[model samples]
Target chain A: MINEEINEIQNIEIRLFLEALFQRYDYDFRNYSQAHIKRRILHRMNLNNFKNISEMQHRILYDPSFVQQILLDLSINVTEMYRDPSFYAAVRKEVIPILKTYPFIKTWHAGCSTGEEVYSMAILMREEGLLNRSQIYATDFNHKVLKIAKEGIYPIDQIKDYTTNYQKSGGKESFSSYYDANYNSVIIDSSLKKNIVFADHNLVTDSVFAEVNLIICRNVLIYFNRELQDKVIKLFLDSLAPGGILCLGSKENLQYSTHFEMFSVIDAHEKIYRKEYRH
Target chain B: MIEQKSFPIYKPLAIVIGTSAGGVEALTKIFIGLRAGFSIPILVVQHISPSSDSYLPKHLNRLTTVSVNEAIDKTSIEEFNAYLAPPNYHMLVEEDRTISLTVDEKVSYARPSIDVLFETASRAYGRNLLGVIMTGANADGASGSKLLREMGGFLVVQDPKSAHISTMPEAALQLAGADYVTNLEGIIEFLNQLK
Candidate 1:
């Protein structure tokens, strides 16, 4: 069909644009899942009033500001406080006991958009009397989102959902005790932010920088192609200490990863896995 | 004659449906009557709570002869199956005839937004796409339905008067001006006519 042909042409243009972006900016999105990237590009096209991918490709090559805008659109920043409460419940019941054994705990919340989950983790640790011994590294590739994450503030309207998730996740204290409300926004308690370090780190381009006891990278790998996902999994494996725990989004699994055997499934429903030590 | 003129006769490569509020009941009526050997892929975005388990596909699968499943990210789409967008994610169609899922911020206060699916599928299928907006409480599908029509895709809406929650269909009719406005049974008859 003529429509199919047109789509194919658009696909080629999109690939070329991605390549040009990498060659010029060193932001390697070449291995991201194509369908997701394409959708983002199409969404960008509609917003910028471009007729086709070819036109967008031209602008990407010629305009720096346009490329930056596209980069923001391409990044998936959807997240919430205590997302998947059951996962947190599993963490409280299963993973935290192992974490308590460590003299000093190191946790990496990779792709920590706006740091909600990071704060959630800190609150959980605080309640368990482990906050003093834990250092949480919250990293994301998008500096724009990273800046917001460092602020420890969120819209007041979303607090209701966060509160429900907290109770579901077995919170010992009232959710209101954690934040100070300022009309439209809630500033997360300053103590909750004390142990968290927010930084810009791209899973695609960056190498493992720290050996951690637990790594929580949820819903981020779904955006990556299989090859890139394998690479990132390898990176996580290298970064994790022996017997370290890895928690993924409910929908994500290590089924296709080459390193699947290296990790023992801790809680299947929660998608929590523990790195196995070689005899 | 006027109705015939409005409903353009053309074979569509795929059908994209968006609904909310009373989507489960409305979708059941449409799927229950679908005859076997239907070939077009049906991608749907039915607004649901983020924490809710995906029971829609399973429920619909029992009622229809055609296969129905929750769409996975980055999978190639196949005809003869209805792919429902999973909770807390937006489902999109890509140029390679594959499904893409995103956790982007909620549009129109919803993830798995009807507008997101319709907008992307319209681009991928172009004039070969058939966009159907059904019973719901919000205006979420209106802009996306408009986009699909702009891309030359056929647009259809459930008659607002007959919809369980009329606002969604009414919005689609007001904003996109569908080629056909019919009740549930009338929409089923129209679908059966597609080759």
Candidate 2:
């Protein structure tokens, strides 16, 4: 019973600490679920060797570097190249048919951490004969990650696996033909990235910038609470052109969202949706 | 009768562990004896195929007292818990207070790549972290463990000879120059002392 109370108290302290973080740092975590927020902060605290949250809070309030460290701990930066290959395959099979009808295309990949998906799209476009005419916008909230994304270099040892993913995603050519391995790292083909622009954008706090023909914001919205998710969905709706394509992560959906009626499913298994034309 | 002196216990805030082929059984043995209410948060990346679905967390949760779950995007790191990177994704902690999921491409033929997690965690946590590299058939986690040690994090490697697959630990020792090299039972005792 005493242990349970200690756990409860720790939970309360974590909440207050997060509240204090918002108040002090202007990073809005107020909308995040308490369980997730508590876990992240405690993880950060332990990493910093703080015996308790109070010590962590004290350091974070005073030290900007500590705040930055805390921020790094809290951000969800896990991702991979050709992630969920079937989704890309679906985009190639289902959406490209409609995309080919257009003369030119502009696509936005929101929350494009380190730009693997962006490059994947560019490769797909190239294969579909749409590369020269299409412009891809890959955006993320973290500037540091964006820089790495722009570099388009990955560990060379991983090529064999990514080659398999590439094949599974229906690559037309040899995966090795795409990049040059320089010892330990693989530098992606510069041609594939030519039409791509990597930038820093936040879905939580930012607004839509352009009317795009397709919007691919996969695996990003799941982190947000319901309200924040709605805000992002609305943002995507506003940004997408009529009859545009919208692709989401596997677990995410447009159902129950305010913009649900505005779009229809292109491929349910792949979670691909297309904005419907009113006229 | 000789009474044992209770030594001062050191608790790590963040624990980073790495494994490859034959790692599941090794991890099960190491984690099985962990005391209930152990308060450190652990981050682990086991080498799994991009298509492999890990039932590791579920299995570990059943055997251990700590809460275990697949690491989710934006999920906070918590005390007395364990997080395993889901298959086909490299798990990284961002500089901000949220989890970022990237589909950037695989490192060393792994999606939930051990090197990516260990390197990023070392960068994020520095000396306050504890790193353990375990049994496997590959050399994936070696360089990352080296970086963790260079950054002042505590290093622990599983005994290579005792491991079912020794290549991973042998590689890590050669590359990272581990601070503590022991068998599974020793690691459990070490963790219990912390608890």
Candidate 3:
């Protein structure tokens, strides 16, 4: 058979695997970018010592344990505290003033990954004296990451990178003050942990949980296909209170989003936007 | 190497190019010689610093007849356009022919990995894909080119003596075994003749 015919057959098998995954487990990855999803599946297949995607799918249908591994593979766990320092700096300079005007603020960090950015935002709010009045909801589809994020314990080696990022983002206090260093890991200060809620929320399947004042779902939407991106952006628009600030990943934009007109750009470079008030 | 049998007769659907160390200059020369009316989509992974700007695409677009762009997430591949993978993301081609960017772990100490692009493009376009490995310091593209060849895709490597950095092409020649090993000028001549 020509390569095109083989490719077409392989595509069908992958869709079947994804469909079976959705029907068997409620984890809906159907709308995720097909290319990325395939890469992850292929990677997972290699890791599990399986030869092809069909073999992986066969096991996925029968083996519950294998499904868990696939879940972790599919959800990208790559993140760091204060990732892209300029993004945090923009949050401090551009968004903080508007946030300061509010009496009480509710911020949602959707797809919070392992909660590095959640802690980053909390620290920023604390420095601005907004933490006392703010409630941060950090959510991710992977509870494994959510648990790690809730504990706020990161490896000791990563602290240097996090420290440099913190200082670059205009951190007020010493970076060391925020975490208690154990032998191998540094536990984030319990004081900073206050007023933060870490929960399981799937951006693909879950609906709006709260009408937040500031929504920071950075770098998460890039994994979704354009159709899913549009749907999630609409969810963000629905979840935001009028004039609420929405911050996406540095590479993500609202240009193609149908709800593009609903938000005015606050910092075009940082991908910060504010919801337009209803007429 | 310029023999009739060496050239692919099946109207190539996509062109995948990989380069690293001296890619900008080498790719510039290759693209400058590319005339208008070539319709196959070009996907490129030029190793760059994660923090670098979109200057490469903008600069290449100025010198080339085909429009060049930094690949955007979920953008469909267009004929007569060259898409440069953005910094810090692995660019992959989907079965649907759309470009997908991932911030997954870096392969070969690079995120915009040529291996990732070539391997995924091979899966999408198969023998209809044209894979090129050019000047670079690392061996990132060797395995990818092998995958392309295994999938019955055409393979070419820049002649190592003519390359700015010989390690990449030399490694590809040793490991991937391309159908054609030619200089920049020869590569330009070959590409221009592709239907």
Q: lDDT tens digits, residues B40-121, model 1?
A: 8899999998888878899999987789999876677888888999999888787668776778788888998999899889
Residue A153 alpha-carbon offset, candidate 1, angstroms: 3.0
Considering TM-score, where higher is better, how would the candidates rank from best to worst?
A: 3, 1, 2
TM-score of each: 0.86, 0.61, 0.94
Ranking by lDDT: 3, 1, 2
CA lDDT, candidate 2, residue A65: 73
RMSD of 3: 2.1
Model no. 3, DockQ: 0.62
* TM-score for predicted model 3 compared with the true structure: 0.94
* Weakest lDDT window of 10 consecutive positions for candidate 2 chain B: B1-10
Candidate that would win on DockQ: 3
Candidate 2: regions farther than 4 A off: A23-25, B1-195
Tens-place lDDT per residue, model 1, A1-279, is: 465566678778888988988898778889887767877888788887899988888888888877668878888887889999999999999998998888999999999988899999999999999999888999998888898899988999999999999999999999999999999999999988888888889999999999999999998988888789899999999999999999988877787789999999999878999999883
Q: Kindly list the per-residue Cα lDDT of model 2 for residues B1-195, writing each as its tens digit.
A: 111223324566688889988888878887888887778888888887657555778888898878888876656678878888877666776434234444434666777677777766765666677888888988888888877777667788888988889998898888878777778898788777774
Instruction: Quote the chain B TM-score of every prediction.
Output: 0.96, 0.91, 0.96
TM-score of chain A of each: 0.97, 0.92, 0.97
Question: i-RMS values of the candidates, in order?
Answer: 3.0, 10.2, 1.7
CAPRI tier for the interface of model 1: acceptable
